[model samples]
Target: MKFNVLNLIFAIVLITNCDIAFSQKLAVIQIEDLYLTSPPIENKKTSISYLVEPSDNIVIQYYTCILNDEFSTCKSDDLLSSGETEDYSISVSIPKDLAGKYLSYCISAISKSGAYLPSENECRSELITNGDIDNKNALFSYLNQTKNFSLYNAPITDAKDDVSFVTSNSAALSLSSEGDASLIGYGSEVTNAPNLPKAKEVYSMLDGFAIKSESDDAIIWGQFDTTPSYINQVEEIFPAPYAMAAILKDGGINTAGDMVRGGSISSEAQKRIDKLLSKDGLPKAIYHTAQAFLAVFDMPSGKQKLVAWGQSIYGGTLPDEMKSALSIKDIVTSQDSFTVLDNDGNAYSWGHSPFEQHQNIQTVYATRYAFAGITTSGKVKAWGDSYYGGLLSSAAIDFTNTNPITRLCASDASFVAISDGNKGVAAWGNDYGAGYIPSNIQTELDATTITDDFHCASTEKAIALYDSSHLFVWGDKKYGGALPSNIPTFSIANVIGNNHAFLMKAMDDVYAWGGLNQGGCIPDGHQCLSSDDSSLNLRSAINDLSDISQIGSFNTFSEFEEEVVGGFYVRGSGAVVMWGNSVPDGVFNE
Candidate 1:
């Protein structure tokens, strides 16, 4: 390496004499106490920390050159401000790429007046090879200390290194609540995302997660193509069982993942399509179901327009009245028909025996094969396949003056309505589904003394009830209608259900029941039950249930709506915990 000593000397004299013209005193700027904070390491940033006098307006100029590369020259292109110090010391990061090479570095301070700080040029001159291993036997000495635990019964030994555990191939690492670390059996190598910020919000789609950062960046992991979409700030995401769409901050619409034929796309094409929607207007909201996707946009003409895609039951054509409606109040769907309620109290239905004419509709509910509407006067009307709750039975209509129906919910094949006064609940639709309230639950409902705060959820064949104090479930036992026999008592705070399973967050823990590989199972390390039937207490595995802010299923269901694939638990800290099947069975996005 060559140095322009004569030039530096000339520049220093000029700055020194110029400073005397103003301050009438020569500046005593100098770099002091320079040293490497740690030994240089391969493939890792090496820090050099130092303390300096009179830190203001000082710039740190650092130069490095590989020791044996005769063609290499030292360069000081990067300058760090002296004001950016920590704990009375400033640090400089040495590039991690200098592995297996001896390196020489020089650090000096320069004042704003262009005067160089006097320091020992011989300091940090010794040649040291960046931490590079030449022998396989020495690799263990560089490994991070790990606990003697492995998920696959492989032997584990504690190593002495203090760095993060490194994996060369497909090895997976799992950390326990106790901080015990284990390596899962190797499969494929995982690469970390470059410069990803901390996650702020996350949402789950059919088989992956959409993560939003505090910086407003949105990224996806699991089941997405490798190419990045480079999304703008995401405002909201609407995820359906089979497909998903999102609205950007600029009101541009982006859609991805899961198609009618079970395909998916990355955000690339979605960005191109965003131009099409941008010409119309910004989307106020987007909605999706297993069969189709829809968006409502505020047009430039001061009117709202609706767009639909995929195999919609309406066959890409909306009703004339719906197209001209001033504004849509709500839109809902059953298995074969889609319903829309307009702001003017008119309701429209199309596909699979659409209801003729409905007016003054306050609310609407649906089972797979039926639709029920409650008019402003509180009268309930039903239509579609009578056997699947298209028509209410006489018993279901018997609302007394004291016990009036308050709310309605549905399983895949049935409708359930709960009354206000005595907590009475009535059901109609397929018998084996939630259509018939069990006699035991009916007795409990009739005997209920409290009249408020009842929450309910349902799967394909069962309904779960959380009455302020107790949880009651009824329907088909095989599909999570009944609580698992070994589960602890329920003071359930919340409950979520996909088609085949139910997940409940209770006072002490979270629990699930149904098909083991579906939403019923938590991830391996967090399982509530051990192979020996000992209680692991899932909340302990998760640290605490209260940290979780929301829970939901991917909502993947079988063709007959008999099984759920997986679910997600979103923590208040913006970390999402996903369980069940993560990979789609077929080539969904290919």
Candidate 2:
């Protein structure tokens, strides 16, 4: 809690476990992926996916190590290498002896030269065991905790401290649409990415949606079903690189963003907002909503001003208190959470504050669930509980004392902070899976950051804009590698991430990877070109953008699916084309 008497601010999103390597070698051999049964047991089948350099012969070995505090090998298997395309899949059997125990394992590829490359789970997985909690001991349990996940039923409806219903005090948190697209109110218990709020049948469901993405939910703007005239007015106010947004048109207000199109604010929230907007009315909305933080730019009294709102939960509405607490400046959401920074350089934080106590602060950077602040003394402070060593780990915190962090981006579990001094990037967080960044690219992320005025983005992975506006990536390659071998880097106007990639090239062209099977990234009428190697939506409007003003992308991730499973995209021109496993059949067909 150190104070330097200066002001500063920061954005949150969660991530899936993934790692993709970017290599530039004469011959590269990589263990691209390894998927196995969740909580595996005896006789269950396990799998591995990998990549080998072109025309190279390689051998892959599956190695297993003891789970509980070990330093010894358990079993190993050597297998023939396919040395095939990036999307190859292979399988192995789970040993019965490892049932119930968490064993660490990995796949190593042996090159024709006997050179070996090892996968870094040093890979870990747990198998269901025969042991069960003693029934007598369970009877005396404290919270009646179960084996793993537990659901608390008959939830008390009233708790003064409960923030979920804090917006009940407002009139908008519960409102539904009346005229067009009325069915956008509720659904048949559909699903989205893990931890992502379900899509309500309202325009607000589209809040924070974008056009090219790697999310796990489907966002089909009104244009997908029936075109709405108000869409024509979207850009004049809510413009490019849009985030969580609220719109007022034809006597109605709805939500908009990179991941969704339009939906109504809950009734309670609307009422709360009605009170505040009694004089001038609700403002248009955010340009793009990342990290779930919302903001609007307005010209009050002839000068352009930024108005921001914080902590917009499900239903795309912020609590009444948040809007009321807003002041003069604008703030963007961290990937899906908030990093509270004040004008006095003092930060108020709870559980795991990323800042060091008694350290003067300059600014704070928000990870999906944590916060990292740059002290005026040029050091960093990360607060909040980190699930993996990827975040705030000693290896992740290797910041040089002389360099100051200039900007940052977050995947669901990691952080990519750029150095102002041109040294390199400071990245840490769920360093496994697609979030696993390439070792050599660390220099690229750093060089790209210090050299350009660009933005960083992520999903299960991460990508940053290089000097040419073309992209330089680390993290997982499914989304990162999807970038065409020859990107028109100099023309890239904007870029964002779901750890998958979406870009605005030449300020007119668009390219994406991750959710094309569902039409999330592919433009209409165009053949599927997703980086994940699926060909589903090749005839949608998004695939055919020309003279387009701007683009936005959205996605959700399912830990249960163990992969990003849904996505959709939107145009600043009001085109809402969606694609993903979660999308309705023929939803985006012309």
RMSD vs true structure, all candidates: 26.3, 25.2
| Residue 473 displacement in candidate 1 (angstroms) | 1.3
* Cα lDDT computed for each candidate against the true fold: 0.50, 0.36
| lDDT of each residue in 161-234, candidate 2, tens digit only | 12111010000011112211212111221212112233222222221121111222223332222322223223
TM per candidate = 0.55, 0.43
The list of candidate 2 runs beyond 4 A from truth reads 1-203, 206-339, 351-359, 388-396, 421-423, 433-436, 443-449, 467-469, 479-488, 499-507, 515-546, 556-563, 570-577, 584-590
> What is the C-alpha lDDT profile of model 1 across 3-65, one tens digit per residue?
443234335544554644355344555554454444445444545555556677665545444
Residue 132 lDDT in candidate 1: 23
Query: Can you give the lDDT of residue 196 in candidate 2?
Result: 25
lDDT of 1 at 476: 82
lDDT over C-alpha atoms for residue 320 of model 1: 55
Give the C-alpha lDDT of model 2.
Answer: 0.36
Which residue pairs clash in candidate 1?
A: 170-188
